[model samples]
Target: MSTSAKDIGRLFSPLQIGSIVDCVEPLSAGSEAGWALELLAERPELEVVPIERDGAVLGVVSRHVLEGIVESAWKRFWQKDLDAYVVPARRSVEATDYVDRIVAVDLADVEKDDPGWYIVNHRRAYLGIVNLRTMLEHLNHLRSLDLRRAGEMQKHLLSKKPDEDPRFRICFYNRMAHEIGGDFYRSTQIGEDRWLVACFDVAGKNISGALATSALGAIFACFKLFAYAGEAQLTTGLLNALVHEVNPGDVFVAAALFYLDMKAMTVEIHNCGFSPVLAFIPQENRKIACKMARPNLPPLGIEDRMVNDAPQLIPITPGLRLTAYSDGLTDMTDPFGERYGEERTIEYLRTLHKSSQADIPGLVGTEVDKWIGESHLADDITLVDLRFL
Candidate 1:
């Protein structure tokens, strides 16, 4: 509903215990107390994990634990090889752990005075004290307005299209490392004889990715408007021209441009880094048919090597379905750390064809989740299926 610090805290607080977070800086559990002080000053929010050598708060340090290590100061610790330090964890506490009192004692009575704080187990392992104020501020910062807007944009991006039976079915999904990501897709009929279907992924995460994707979407919409004018159809030249108009960098889209000619039963395709364009003909017993397409050109803005490449030709016979997809579908990793690679993807397509169903997008999503054993898809997944009946 609302993006707020409390929402984030509630989501993350429960998982805080045993959560192994990397140290933002490095600290040491040694005589160099300045290192600990510096780390504490820089990141007061994070609790330091203190190391205990002979059962004392040997001193305090963090995991990155060495942010205070200047290049000049490295020779001191580098010589000893005692650079590694882990925090002394908490064990148990006594009645005086949370108690504070002003005791009247002689200066000499300090010999037996144990001004110890909270103890872990029965011994002293230092779990750095938490800074409540800093923690709260960090939590509140996450509830800012920009994050909320980005979340809303992602919702709009992922919104389902209205059910309709057109010439093709196009569906898209993006994992978006943050509130925004780079993946985008579009389908448009350029003219009576040509159609354009495209999918692309920008290079970064969050706002940069969203901006790049938005730019591509704008380009797609403008091209679609031209196509809708019925003045000139989208061709390789037109596609290249639109790309040339956009400002380079922050955007890299791996897309495939398809030009379908129904009368001639032919399809012309410009494959730009998108892979596994599986063509299945029902008359061929739904067997997976590979089109002899040209090698993928380099992605946008990286190199100018793709200025001219031969378009691959494929015969779009009757009762055939043409499918092209992005790398996300194949780059998925299962729970066992195994990738659902291109080979497995093609096999899945053949199985779907074997079932002979009018609706395949929904089925494709199901099969992918089943293979991965979870619905938590980490990449931007897109699939475009065109059935020429």
Candidate 2:
């Protein structure tokens, strides 16, 4: 099925893109061929891509590709990872080509997406099949219709507009994921002497989480307009009101809101139920990690009441940096299922602290992406970093 640029937006909606898996690894190709067949039987609509060998495309297996190869001998011989099966590619396309070509052609006509996937080569090689879902996602973000407008909306979300402020710098980098995530950030003056900087994440990914987050931003903006808070009650009340507006099953937002006292060089932190906030101190050459006491209340909307009524105030020192992020940072699994959890997070933060580079946000962001390697993100990631100048 070919779709025009005009229709691509509807095609890549959260519902459609979420339906496709980035890649799937089948059970041993040489052993348990019967089991593999049974697996495909359960998910008949899924398209399967075989691992490539040397320079040849092997395995024509899809959910239905193995129905005919049900014999015991076939299953036993081909069940081994690469030994049993050797399906060669009859044809292939370079990844760097154009999108219109693929869209104009029927799915049966072309072996890949409109342009296909491209690697970082002078002459990039043909890199596997372009499943239907990936093609639609690529077009939805960059297609002809309202491309400029989409850029502006993302800019507004990130608050990256050039004229917003010259005193502070904010940088946002999203390395082309399937959906827009829950990372929301903002900087505004709450009092003549105080400025607020926030970095937070909502649960889930794509539009479902994005809608809740966008609404959360609206709520904060409304609160800022009507009832600005120097008091914990006001802040928690606003959080309860926002939570009450959303449905019960929705994931909650974990955030750290800082009211900076520039004159005193101090800040007050409200640890609503989220990950424990870490304060990185250079003098101690170590971190002071703070955890809110348990009996900790539910995050934001759970009961429309502050779960933990006491406010924790920590002293902020000059030359010390504050790192706040959602669980996505610590919860990511290596392809082997090892988590890049709190221990690694502190280690990485320490390494960056010693470095002479000044762009803290970008430096930490880049390292996190490299750590994940080929493993895709399962949730939205938002990191808010503040360093006193």
Provide the TM-score for each candidate, comma-separated: 0.56, 0.54
TM-score of decoy 2: 0.54
RMSD of every prediction = 15.9, 16.0
Tens digits of per-residue lDDT, candidate 2, 102-157, equal 54563465454332321111134422344444656656755534545544454476
Worst 10 residues of 2 by lDDT: 113-122
lDDT for 115 (candidate 1): 22
Tens digits of per-residue lDDT, candidate 1, 283-320, equal 45555565534345655555433464555677766566
- lDDT for every model? 0.52, 0.53
* Model 1, runs deviating above 4 Å: 1-148, 154-178, 226-251, 282-288, 292-294, 303-306, 355-359, 374-377
TM-score of 1: 0.56
lDDT measured at residue 137 in model 1 versus the true structure, 0 to 100: 39
